[model samples]
Target: MFASPAYAQAAGAAGSSSGSTIFMLGQFVLIGVIFYFLLIRPQQKRAKEHRATIDAVKKNDVIVTAGGIVAKVVKVDETEVEVEIAPNVKIKIVKATIADVRTAGAGKPAND
Candidate 1:
């Protein structure tokens, strides 16, 4: 019931060389395209949206940091921002660390 190693390898390689190598190369490209669309494309889109969100932040905007701290923007600089976490308590954080920017009416009580 046992086959020699050399015989087994030759049996496996027998029909494989009859196939077009171009088809194998095309399969790799197809996989690359699928990966780009399913993985890399969405990542790039999210990165673009995040860039737009970070760029639109302004003074008085409420922001949540990547660290999950909520703060009010006090100043906007090229690469950093000053935010007020509490009354008279301000901290400087890098712009890239901001995770979210709240809309105009966000965080305010609706009925008031």
Candidate 2:
């Protein structure tokens, strides 16, 4: 019962501080934009370029497989390919298993 009117003034300041909820939401949105540009966008672009390279593969291309086998393309179809790894040995593998392609100008490998 001895409290003065200053207690009522402090309660008014506390009510206004709750208005910063909008500022907190803006901060979260800013962080999300930064993460997308710095991390997510680059990863997606690299994956898209890699997919384009894989889809453009043709016959006579030299390629390295995921299993570390280097071979020359003997035949190519929609989803599978025949790769000649040795003089007379050819193995059939799925197209998705190819990890890297050696361009024509890269020169003939030692084994070719």
Candidate 3:
């Protein structure tokens, strides 16, 4: 009973537009999944590793701070670290603020 050409044209147009919309939505979801797997997941994993590194800190380790300060660990606690940025110059910072640990044997004065 397809007598009205105008009605058929309108139905076709609506169907095509709906299909395009669904295709766009699927594309967006795929992109989001790819981003999570390729970008967000790796970043989160790296953050977890960095946190573990900070938690395992011990004295005499060489560490770089988030503020770009390089210091040697004088003391390490559950929540904080005392770093000797220079001889006889110790500063306390949060353990989470440490960016990197250079080595385990670092900061130990010779002959100790």
| Model 1 pairs in collision | none
Better of 2 and 3 by lDDT: 3
> In angstroms, how far off is 32's CA in candidate 2?
1.2
TM-score attained by model 3: 0.78
lDDT of 3 by residue, 3-112 (tens): 79888898888869978999999999999999999999999999999888888888778888899888888888889999888788888999878889878655443323
Task: Please give, for residues 1-112, the per-residue lDDT of candidate 1 as tens digits.
Answer: 4569879898888868657576888899999999999999999999999999999999888889999888888899999999888878889999999999996557621222
The candidate scoring highest on lDDT is 1
Per-candidate Cα lDDT values, in order, are: 0.86, 0.84, 0.84
Candidates in order, TM-scores: namely 0.79, 0.76, 0.78
Model 1 CA deviation exceeding 4 Å by range: 1-18, 108-112
lDDT tens digits, residues 1-112, model 2?
5466788888887897767777888899999999999999999998888778778878888888898888888888889989888888888999899888887666453476
Model 1 weakest lDDT span, ten residues long: 103-112
Residue 1 Cα positional deviation in candidate 2, in Å, after optimal superposition: 18
Pairs that collide in candidate 2 are none
Q: Which regions of candidate 3 are displaced past 4 Å?
A: 1-11, 106-112
TM-score of 2: 0.76
